[model samples]
Target: MKENVALIGWIATVMTGVVAPALILALIWKTPDTLLRTGEAGQFVSATASVGGFFSSDITTVQSTTGSIAVYNTFSAPRNQLLVVRETLKNGLQLCAENKPDTCVGLAGSWAGDMKPVPHARHRFAGLVTGIGNSGASLWLLIGILVSVGATGILAQHVDREGRRRS
Candidate 1:
């Protein structure tokens, strides 16, 4: 009787967990792209994001480096605004040559809002992940949860209590 009751409880728990996520996914799948129309609301959101991104993060308004240029704001945060205008190359300032236009060197490229400073961050490794993460914070939260779960799993493997001992 006890085993049967426990089995039923386990099944219910599994069903609730699986069904809730499935239903949510189905709803999202059925949702139309036009659900959130682009107009005043979109513009307002973009404006808010630009202002908020600038204040919340260590984003410089304008940055010019040897290989690229960067501007941090909601609209441009995901990618560096690299524009090339006609100019005479008589001389380049040490600051410009060194790419130290204040927070400019750190940005490597578009994936980095400039160019990648990290080791071996080749083009193959899709920038969409980092780009989205850089622009929106929701990705960070999802990554954090994944990392926490993995860490907890590792701890569970190694940090077990002592086995029961009998005299």
Candidate 2:
């Protein structure tokens, strides 16, 4: 009976895990391209941009190293945004310089928003974009909640004891 109960709980968790995100995406996104939209409209779209210098004071935003230029919001958390942008730049280097030499430098490009940041951090960051729209800025918040809930439930099932152990 206890095993049955555990099984049911696991199934419930799994169902909720899947259904909740689906429902949220359906209601929030409301379109097929929603996930791919950029800058407040949808998930961060991938683009190529020039490499600006890094900052020790505020790593969340990458400023243009040279002349007054656009700053990328990064849309990353305070903790890992630097690294995420670094990797993205690494990939972009390969894609733009190696893959397509013609578009290596100059000109405006799009950037994919990364949401992997420290959950406890209490900062909301923005980046430079081609243009701004009125899309909700809380999409990252929603994705974070879904991931946290799903992970917590899974951890509970694994760590939970079915009954008291016999001596």
Candidate 3:
């Protein structure tokens, strides 16, 4: 029974020390590689400054205002560009707006975005923007590291406590 408890503790320690961090990294990695690659290559634009043609009809805005935008190669329409933008509005409203004629409406907030070249697709590019106020890859990496370290510390403390109790 004693041996079993120790083994369980060790297993927990190992999992917390290794598995937790590995899982976080895997989750981040599992996201479509193309999306990450595209953001790295795409241009960063500011929506407030550059975006024009301001039109909104009860625009469903949200406090967090997080969203994603991506451009994908259209296999059916090889000659045309497909731009996709997904946003979380402030409220439940269908407000439509676009940039002014010939004007480039920048992305809103501190959005992390990227652009990548599509393979086998002529003159086509793909990109994504995480959305407003997202901390981006660097921040997520930092968070993962911090959480792993914290978990390890907590496990170490638990082991120490158990050791003291046994002795």
Q: lDDT score, residue 34, model 2?
A: 14
Candidate whose TM-score is highest: 3
The digit string of per-residue lDDT tens for model 2 on 24-85 reads 44443432211111111122223323444665221122232112222333222122111112
Please give the lDDT score for candidate 2: 0.33
Every model's Cα RMSD, please?
A: 16.6, 15.5, 13.6
Which window of 10 residues has the lowest lDDT sum in candidate 1?
36-45
Residue 27 lDDT, candidate 2, scale 0-100 = 45
In model 2, what is the error at residue 157, expressed in angstroms? 14
| lDDT per residue as tens, model 1, 1-167 | 54455446545544444443444444433433221111110111111222434335443333333233332332222233232221111111111112222322222123222222334323321222233222233444445455555555644443342112211
Candidate 3 structure, TM-score to reference: 0.28
State the local distance difference test value for candidate 1. Answer: 0.30
lDDT of 3 by residue, 57-151 (tens): 12112111233332211111111122222232111111112221122222333335333433433211111232312224345456655666765
